[model samples]
Target chain A: MPNQHLIEARGVTKVYQTKDGAVESLKPLDFSIREGEFISVVGPSGCGKSTLLKMVAGLLPVTAGTLELAGKPISGPQRDVGIVFQSSVLLAWRTVLDNILLQAEIRRMPKAEALAKARQLMSMAGLAGFEGKYPWQLSGGMQQRASICRALLHNPSVLLMDEPFGALDAMTRETMNLELQRIWSESKKTVLLITHSIPEAIFLSDRVMVMSERPGSIAAIYDIDLLRPRTLDMMGSPAFAVFAKKVRAHFYSQGTLDH
Target chain B: MLRRLLLLPALRPFLLIILLLVLWDLAIRIFKIPAYLIPRPEQVVQQLFAEWPRLLTESWKTTQATLGGFALTILIGIPLAMVIAYSKLVESYVYPLLVFSQSIPKVAIAPLFVVWFGFGIFPKIISAFLLGFFPVVVSTVMGFKSVEPDMIDLARSMGASRLQTFFKFSLPQALPAIFSGLKVSITLAVVGAVVGEFVGSNSGIGYVLQVANGNFDLPLMFAALVVLSTIGVLLFVAIDLIERLMIPWHASQRQVF
Candidate 1:
C-alpha cells in the first residue's frame, strides 16, 4: 500500500548543530499522501514544519530514514517536484513570463514549447497582460500568483508550497486560496502545503497533519470529509469548526510543553 | 515641471567655473591684473579656437589611449574577479596584492612608466590601465559575491548546473554594482592618461598645458584645462548612458525624468 503512495516518508529525522550543541529539528516521523491528494502540514513557528518540507523537496538532506516519491528514493531534487516559497523570489530583473519559463530554460527544453507553456500558464493565472512586466512592477499578490504559475509551468507531478499565502492580506489570501483550489482541481497535481493557519489548512487540504514542537513529530492527522469544490460557507459549518478545534488543541499542547 | 527642473542637483564644478570666470574677468579689469598672470574667459575661448586643429588631434590621441586602456582593464579585470570570487585561495593571494598595488601613488609612477616605455602612447595607456583596473576588479568581486544565499539555493534545488547558476543569476545581479565601479573608473582613466602626459609626452591636453606654462601663455593653459575637464565629464556621461541602456532594470538607471 505504501508503494502506491505518491510520497512516503519513513522514520524521517533531522538534527542541526548550533554553537549550543545539537538541536533536534525533527524526530523519527512517518507520513504519506496518496497520489493527487492535497495535504497541509500545520504547526507553530520553529516547529520544524519547514525542515520536513525541505527534506521532502530534497533541498535539505534527511538525517535518517528513507523518503520516496513514486517508489523512487529522493536522492536529490527531483524534476517532478515543483516548489513555491513564501517570498515570490521571481528574480527581480526578469519579466514575469521569463521567470515562469526559468524551469524550462534550466531543463533545456525546446524554446518554442517553453514559451508556449509559459504563456498558457500566465493567462491561466490571470496574468496575461502582465507577462512583460518585471517582478517589482507587480503587486505582492500578483507576484506570488506569477510564482505559482512558474511552479506549474514545468508541469510537475507534485507542488511543494511552503507558506505561499502567508505573506498576503486576509482578502487576497482567501481569493488566492480559491484560485489555488481551482488550479489544483484542473491540474490534478499532488500538493504538500506548510501553513500555521488552521482554517487555511482545513480549507485547502484534503488532510491536515498537525505537528508538535521542536523535534517535531506528527501530533495528529485530520481528514476533511467535506465535499469537493468546497466553498467559504463550509468554514461556518460545525464539521469545519470541530476540525479547527482539534488542530488548535495540538498547538495549545505544544505551548504547554515549554513548562 | 520646468520649475522643478531648475531645482535639480547642479554639478558643483560647473558652477565653480562660472564664478571663477566672473572673478577672473573682474580682477583683470578692476585690479589691472596682467594677461600673463590670469586670462579672461574671452581670451581663453579665442585661444581654444585659434589652436582648434592641434587641440582636436591631441584630444583624439588622448581619447584613444584612455579608451584602449579602459577596454584592456575590462577584459582583464572581470575574468580576474570571477576567478577570485569562485576560489578562496585565489582571493587570499590576489586581493592583498591588488590592494597593495592600488595604494601606490599612480602619479609618482607615471614618470617611471615613461622611462620604461619611452615618450609614446604605450606609457599613457599602461598608466590608464593601472588606474582603471583595480576599481573594476573590486566592484565586480562585490557584485559576484553579493548574490543572495536563498536565490542560489533556489536555483540549485531546481537542478541548475553551476555554470547555469552563474550565467542566469550571479552575472546579471552583479551588473548594477559593476556599473557603479565602471562609472568611477571611466573618470579615473582620463586622469591617468593626463598624468602620463604631465610626466612626459609630446601630445594631448596635458602636453599643451605644459607648453603654455613654459611660454607663460596663461589663456592657452586655462583652455587646455577646460578641455581636459570637459572630456572627463563627457566620458562619465557616456558610461552612464551605456549603463542605462544595458541594465535598464537597475535602480540607478530608473531616472524619474
Candidate 2:
C-alpha cells in the first residue's frame, strides 16, 4: 500500500542556544502531512513556521521528538524533498533553464530525462519561453515562478515552500495561486506551504494550519472545503472569508500584531 | 552624422584625448617651454617614431614582468580568498598578516627583492605580485562572503556537496567582485614592475625613462610615460573584456557595452 502519511512529526521542538540563553523557537509539535495533501501553515512572523518547514526539509534539526519522511527520520538534507524559500533565490549567474537543471546536476539525474522534465515543468509554471533568460532579466513574479520550477524539477514527492509568493505583488500573488493549484494537481506532489496571509493559506491549501506566537504551537487546523481547481472568484466567496476570519481570529486572540 | 559618431560612447574617450593633445601642443607653443623640460606634442610623437624599436623591446619586457606577476597574483589570491572566505579561524590568522604586508611600502621593499633575487625579470615579477595580490585577495574574499545565505540553503537543500556549492554557486557569485579587484591590481602590477626596474633593472620602460632622464631627453620620457599608461589601460580593458565574457548575466556588465 502507498504510505498514508508522507511526513509525520511527533512532539518536534526547537530551542536555539543563544548567548543570552536558550530561546524556545517552537513548542513540542505533533502533526502529520498525508501523501498528495496540500497544507499551509499560517502564523505570525517569528512564530517558527519557517522552523517547522526547515525541519520538514531536513535543512534544520528538531531539538526533540521525531520527524519522519517515508518512515525515515529527517536528519540532514533529504534527496526526496524540495524546498522554496520566501525569496526565489535564483542564481544570478545561471540562466532560467540551467538554474532549474541545478537539481539534476546535484542529484545526478540523467541529462536527457532531466532536460525533458525541466521543459515540461517550465511550461506548467508559465515559464516556457524564458529558458535562456537570467534571473535579473525576469520580473519579480517570473523569477519566483522560475524558482518554483527549479524546486519541482527533481519530481520530489513533497514540495516545502516557505512563503514562496510572499515577495510578489497582490495581482501576481493571485495569479500565482491559480498557477500553483494547476501545477500541484498536475504534478501530484504533496505540498507544505508556510504563509502569513490568511486568504493565501485558505486559497491554496487543502488544510490551513494556524499557529500561536513564538514558542509556536498548533493553534488550530482548519480543513478548506473549497472545490478543486480553486479560482480567484471562489476566494471572494463567503466560504473563503469564513476560513480567513477563523485564521485571523487566532492571531487577535493571541494579541500578536504580526501578520 | 559626424557629431553623432564623435559622441558615440566608444569614440568619446578618443575624442577627449585628441582634444587634450591639441590643448597640450598649444600650451607648449604659447609658453615656449624648452625641449629639455616639456617637449612639444609633435616632438614627443617624433621621438616615439625615432625610438620605436628600443621602446618596443623594453615595453615587451615590462609587459612580460607585469603579466607574470599578475598571473601569479590571481593564482594565489583567489584560492587564498576562498580559504579565508569559508573559515574565520584561518582569516584571523591570515588577514592581519596581509594587512601588515600591504602596510610596508612596496617601493621601500624593492631593494630587498633585488638583494634576495638579483636584478632579473624574476625580481620584477615578484615585486608586481607582492603589490597586486592584496586587493585581489581582499575583494574576492568580500565577494565570496557576500553571497546570500538563502542561495547556500537552496544549494544544500538540493543535496549539493560543499565543493559543488562553492564552484557552481559561490565562485560565480563572487566573479564581479573578483574582476573589480583584478582591475585595480593590474594597474598596481604595472607600477610594481616599474619599481622593480627602478631598483636595478637594465631593461623595461622604467630603465628607458631613467636613461632618458640622464640625457635630458624629455620627448623619450614622454613616450615612455605614454607606453606605461597605454599598458595599464590595455590590461584594464582586457580584464573588463574577460569579466564581460565570464558574467554576461551580471547587471553591471549589461549597460557597460
The candidate scoring highest on DockQ is: 2
Q: What's the CA RMSD for each of the models? A: 3.6, 2.1
Residue-wise C-alpha lDDT for candidate 1, range A183-214, written one tens digit per residue: 89988899999997899999999899988888
- Model 2 segments more than 4 A misplaced: A1-3, A256-259, B255-257
Query: Which candidate has the highest TM-score of all?
Result: 2
User: Please, what is the whole-model Cα lDDT of each candidate in the order they appear?
Assistant: 0.87, 0.91
What lDDT does candidate 2 reach at residue B34? 75
Candidate 1 clash pair list? none
Proportion of native contacts kept per candidate: 0.50, 0.95
For model 1, what is the error of residue B109's alpha carbon versus the real structure, in angstroms, after optimal superposition? 2.7
lDDT of 2 by residue, B102-190 (tens): 99998998989999998889999999999899999999999999999888889889898988998888988999999999999999999
Whole-model lDDT, candidate 1?
0.87
TM-score of each: 0.88, 0.95
